[model samples]
Target: MATNVLICDDSSFARKQMARAIPKEWEVDIHFAGDGVEGVQAIREGKGEVVFLDLTMPNLDGYGVLETIRKEDLPAMVIVVSGDIQPDAQDRVKKLGAMAFIKKPIDAEKAREVLTEYGILTGA
Candidate 1:
């Protein structure tokens, strides 16, 4: 089965960049969300399994998305992709149930590494 992957970011450029960064090994039906509200809605509509979420956005931020995911007990693994590389930001996301965090602009290789570590991708 193809994985349903959601890339949520405010920047259209960043969204496209993230879509390209997903490891080709992952057979995914990619979805895009312009903000956290859309991201949450996409997850509810059953398009979220693995999520690439951006920290800064309009309507809502990644943290709010994380909060809603945890609060509503959404069955999605969130991976934060953000320009905010603060230790506090990382810790907060993890605490809120993100599987991993990747800094922007993302390096495809490093993304693969993190995905592999999280078992979202096998090191094949």
Candidate 2:
């Protein structure tokens, strides 16, 4: 079965970059959310299996979105993709139940690595 993915970022450029980074062979069904509010709404609407979330966003940041997901018991694997690589930030996100914490400026290699590590992608 194809894995469903949601890419949530305020920046259109970042979203596009992430979309392009996903391997074509993965057979993923992709979705998008412009901000944390939209991301939460998308999750409520049952958008995808996994969410690639951005930390810095207007109107409800990624941390808020993660909190909402936990509180609502949303069933989606959330992987934080942010420029913030601070230890405290990583700890906070991990404590909130994120499956993975990936640094931003997301390249194709790093994307694939995270996906594979999370079992979202199998094989080459």
Candidate 3:
């Protein structure tokens, strides 16, 4: 079965980059959101079994989405992809229930490694 994946970012370029970084062997139905508000909505709609979230967005932001997911006990696994490389930022996201964080200009290998290590991506 193809997994549902959401890439939420304010940047169209970033979204496309994220889409490309996903392993070609993995079967996924990719969804795009321009901001965090849309991202959360997509998650609630079951379009986001695994979410690639951005830290800085216009309507809600990644942290807010994470908080909402935690508060609602949402069943999606969130991986934050951001340009914010601060250690505090990474730590904060993890604390907020993100499975992992990948810095901006995402590397396909690193993303795959993280997903595989966390057992989120399999047989890809």
Full ranking by TM-score:
3, 1, 2
Give lDDT tens digits, candidate 1, residues 1-124: 8899999999999999999988887889999999999999999998999999999999999999999999999999999999999999999999999999999998999899998888888746
Clashing pairs in 2: none
Error of 3 at 96 (Å): 0.3
Worst 10 residues of 2 by lDDT: 115-124
TM-scores for all candidates: the values are 0.96, 0.94, 0.97
Residue 31 of model 1, lDDT score: 97
Q: Which stretches of candidate 3 lie over 4 Å from their true place?
A: none
The C-alpha lDDT values of all candidates are: 0.93, 0.90, 0.94
lDDT (Cα, 0-100) at 12 in candidate 1: 97
